[model samples]
Target: MKILIAIDGSKASGLAVKSAIGLAKAMGKPPTLVLMHADVPLMRRVAAELGTEGTRRYHQENHDHAMKSARTALKRAKLAFSEKLVVDDAGPAIAKAAKGGKFDLVVMGSHGRTALASALLGSVAAKVLSQSTVPVLIVR
Candidate 1:
């Protein structure tokens, strides 16, 4: 089965990845895993301070950290999955990516954060549920 695993370097996202791997193994098909890291734009001050090259370097560092965290999490679960990174915020970008990619399942984490907290935290899983055509399996 094809699975789009949304991760944001959170503990919850790690759980979701583990859950997806377990599901894939249970089904006897190691899923075609597509990992995504949505790049949340930085603050204006931070951007200005970083300037062009510095900002680019900062973004690259963030991307590398996200990828490294994802790889470590997947590795701990012993799951093999391909990865992709997008230069957009988590919510809308994740939904768009999942739909455009035609994934069968959009596996993600359920943050216990409430509406206000979710808004502040930028809940990609919630947005994916709202907009994605594919079925979502949320691992809390």
Candidate 2:
């Protein structure tokens, strides 16, 4: 199966990776995995608050940290697979990527967001569940 695993460098994301791995192992073939890491843009805003040089440093630091997180998640997953790191909204990007890739399934960790919080911010899992034509496996 072609599987897309969404990760955010959190413990929850690690669980999602583990679940995907288990599924792939159970299927008796290495599934096509798309490990996605999404990063929120925060540097320019920080710069506006701190000034030019401060902003530049902040941007650099954030970028490094984001990349580091992506790499760490990938390493922790310990799977050989294709990966995508997106520097925008995660939910939309994940849904778009899944659709574009023609994946059969999407596996992700649930953050256990309350109904109200989910409604207000829009959960990524919820967005994918609603938008994706393929099946989504939400691992809590």
Candidate 3:
């Protein structure tokens, strides 16, 4: 099985990674794991000020920061995996990657927002559920 875990540098995201690790242990044979981080683009003004190289560096830094915790956890578990970082909206980007990569499962963390709050603020997990072709497992 191929599993894609979304890492967003949040405590909730850590739970998602931990849950995936537990899945690996239960399955006996570790499945293929892919770590994905989707970072939103910087504001136009900031990007313009930074220029191309600086913009690239900014993205790289954000990606590195977001992946650090998840990467460390995976490494400590002695698991083999790969990572992908995209500069786009987290919800759609994750959905696209999960479907395009043909992953059997997409694991992610949720904020557990209420219906009214989620409706008002918008929810990444909800968007992925609506848009993704692949099945998703949400860990809170």
- Give all candidates' CA lDDT scores: 0.81, 0.76, 0.94
Q: Highest TM-score: which candidate?
A: 3
Ranking by TM-score: 3, 1, 2
Q: lDDT at 17 for candidate 2?
A: 77
Candidate 2 per-residue lDDT over residues 14-128, each given as its tens digit: 7887787778768866788877766676666664888877755654565455445545655675656776766677777788888888998989888999999999988988988
Per-residue lDDT of model 3, residues 54-87, tens digit only? 9999998998999999999999999999999999
Cα error of candidate 2 at position 127, Å? 1.3
Return the lDDT, model 3, position 23: 92
Give candidate 1's error at residue 51 in angstroms.
4.5
- Which 10 successive residues of model 3 have the least lDDT summed? 21-30
True lDDT of residue 47, candidate 2 = 47
Cα lDDT for residue 29, candidate 1: 60
Q: lDDT by residue for model 1 over 1-140, one digit each (tens)?
A: 78998877778887887787788778866778888877878898988998989988877777778767678867887778888878777878888888898888888887788889988876767888888888988898
In model 2, where do residues sit more than 4 Å from their true spots? 42-78
Q: What pairs collide in candidate 1?
A: none
Q: List TM-score per model, in order.
A: 0.82, 0.75, 0.96
